[model samples]
Target: MSRPSENGLSSETLFFTATWNGDSTRCVARLAPAVEAVPVFPAYDLRAQFEIMRLAREKAGIPAPRTLWFEPDPAPLGTPFFVMERADGQVPPDVMPYTFGGWLHDASPAEQRRLQDASVGILAALHQTAFTAEELAPLGEAGLRAHVAAQRAYYAWAHGRRPIPLLERAFAWLEEHWPDEPGPDVLSWGDARIGNMMFRDFTPVAVLDWEMAAVGPRELDLSWMIFLHRFFQDITTGAGLPGLPGFMRREDVCATYRELTGYEPRDLDFYELYAALRHGIIMARVWQRRIHFGEQPMPDDPDDLVLHRATIEELLAGYEPAS
Candidate 1:
C-alpha cells in the first residue's frame, strides 16, 4: 500500500483491514484534515495520539495499537497523519447501532457478558495504572473545572452556528450543580464507549480512539461506558427490539469497576449528565455539518439533532431515564 509522497518519498496507507496468518488485521493510519466539518476542539495534535498509544502500551501494559511512525507534515498524504499496527477485532458498527443487528445481538447472553466484562476491565486497568505528571501534562490539569473549561471552549466553537436550546440549558445546569470538590485525577479515556474498543471473540484486543484522552477523575470514563450502552438501548427499544438487555447495566458496571480497581466510583449521576451534555454539544456540531452539506434543513428545535433528547431532558429534570 506504499505510494509516492509529494516529495517522492515512499508513503504507506494502512488500509482499515488486512490479513496476517489468514487472520484479519488492521494496520491503520489516522488521517487528519478530517472531512470538512465544524471543529470539535480548537485543534487535534496528531503526535499526541501516537504518543499516548505508545506510552499506554509500553508503561501501562495496556493493549494499545503499536504506533509505527508519525509524519507531522501534511505533504506526505496531503494531510497530517500517523500509522499504527491495528489490533485484531471487530467494532460494533456506529452507523447501524450494534443492538439493531450484528454479531453482538446474536451472541448468547453468556457470550455478551464476556464482552461487557472485558471492556470494563480495560477501563479499570487504565485508571489503576499510574503515570508521572510530566507524561500527562499534555492532557492539561486534572479537575472537573479543567474538563468543563475545555468543553466551554468547544461550546464557543459551535456558538451561533444554530441555536441548541438543550445544550445551553445543560451547560447552565452543570454550572449550578458543579461538584463541591473534584474527584481524584486518573487516566480518563475521553471517549470511553465500547464502540471505541477493538474486540476479538468478545474480548478487547486493543483500546482505540484517544482523541478525547485526558487527565481527570476515573468517573469520566466510567460514566461514558454506562451512558453509551443506555443510549443504544434507548434507540433499539424505541424500535421494538430487546437490544442486548442485561449487558452493561449500571449496577453491574459499577460493581465490576469497583471490584477490579478497588476504588468506588462516585457521583455517577452527575457524570452521566456531564456525558449527555458533552455529547449534546458534539451532536450540534454534527448538525452544522448537515446544514453545510444541505443534507438537512435547519432544525426548528435544536434538540432535534440530539438522538437522546428525551433522555437528556430527563437527566436535567433530575429523573433517571426509563429502563
Candidate 2:
C-alpha cells in the first residue's frame, strides 16, 4: 500500500513526515501492506502488531518506535496501515552485511562487546517486564510448544502445493528432540536481531519490527539474535572475507545474558536450531515471492529455495551440546 518515499527503503514499511507551516514536524512510519500473496507467517495481525510495539515502548521499557494511530479502514490507502514515530540511527545493512565490513565490523573489540551486551540487555529487560494476563492473551501462547504449533500452521500455509521436504524433516527432528522442560515464556521481541534495531554509540536507540512479536520462551529472542549474526558471518566467510567471527558467539551471548538477568540461558542449541527453522520458512516464502515476480526461477529441488538448507541438513544430522 505504501509507495516509495524519500525517507525510507522500499519494503512493507515506508517513512514520511507531516509538513505544517512550511516545516516538517515529525517523521512517521506507515506500516504498509505486504505484497506477498499471503504473509510469511499466517498469524499476521495489524492490531496485535500495533499494540505489541506500544507495549514494548511503554510497558516493557524497551526502545521501540512509538505507534501514534491506526486506521483500520482500507479505503484511505487500499489497505489498513498504522503510523509510528521513526527512530534515527544506523542499521547494520543486509545487502553488504555488517560482518562483511561495516562500522560494526570495524569497531574495536571493547566497543563490539559493549554493543553485544547492550543488545542482549534489550532481551533481558523485555523478558523481565511484568504484564497482565489480559495483555498476554492477544500475544501468541507461552513456550516453545505454542511456537511449534504456530510454525506448523505457518508452514502448512506456506507450503501448500509445492512442498519443501527439508522443512518437513526439520519439523520431525524438533518433535523427536523436544526439550524435556522448556523455560517460562516472556514478551519476546519476535524479530529480535541487530538489523531490526537502530543503534547510536553502539547502543540500541530503538527496536523496530514487531510483526513477529509474541509471548514465548526468552531463548526464542536470544537464539534469534545469535543465529542471525551467525548467518551473516557465514555469508561473509563464504565470500572469503574476514567477518566479525568472535562477535556474538553463542557462549558469549549466553554468558552476557546470564550476567545481566539472573536467569541462566538454557536449551540454546534447541532454540538456535529453531531460529534457523523459522528463518528457513521465511526465506522459502521470500523465494516464492521472487519466483512469482520473475525475480528468480524455481529451482529443480525445492530445498534449494531455502538459502540455509545446509544448516537444516546439519541440524538434522545430529544434536550436539554447545561446548
Strongest candidate by TM-score: 2
lDDT of 2 by residue, 109-213 (tens): 999998999999999999999987788777857777878898888888887688899988888878878889888878888889888888899999999777787
What is candidate 2's TM-score against the reference?
0.92
Q: Candidate 2: what lDDT?
A: 0.81
Candidate 1 deviates by what RMSD? Answer: 5.6
List where candidate 2 sits over 4 angstroms from the true fold.
Answer: 1-11, 19-24, 32-39, 320-323
Clash list (residue pairs), candidate 2: none
Worst 10 residues of 2 by lDDT: 1-10
**Candidate 1 residue runs with Cα over 4 Å from true position:** 1-26, 34-40, 319-323
Model 1 lDDT per residue over 1-323, tens place? 54322110012344565666888655778766454544555577778778888888888777888888888998877879988885667887665789898888889988898999888898888888899998888777777888888888887877565567887888887777777866789878788888877788998887877878888988899899988888888889999998878888888999999889888888888889999888877766666667778998877777788868988988887743456
Inter-residue clash pairs, candidate 1: none
Model 1 per-residue lDDT at 58 = 88
Q: What is the C-alpha RMSD of each candidate to the true structure, in Å?
A: 5.6, 3.0
What lDDT does model 1 reach?
A: 0.79
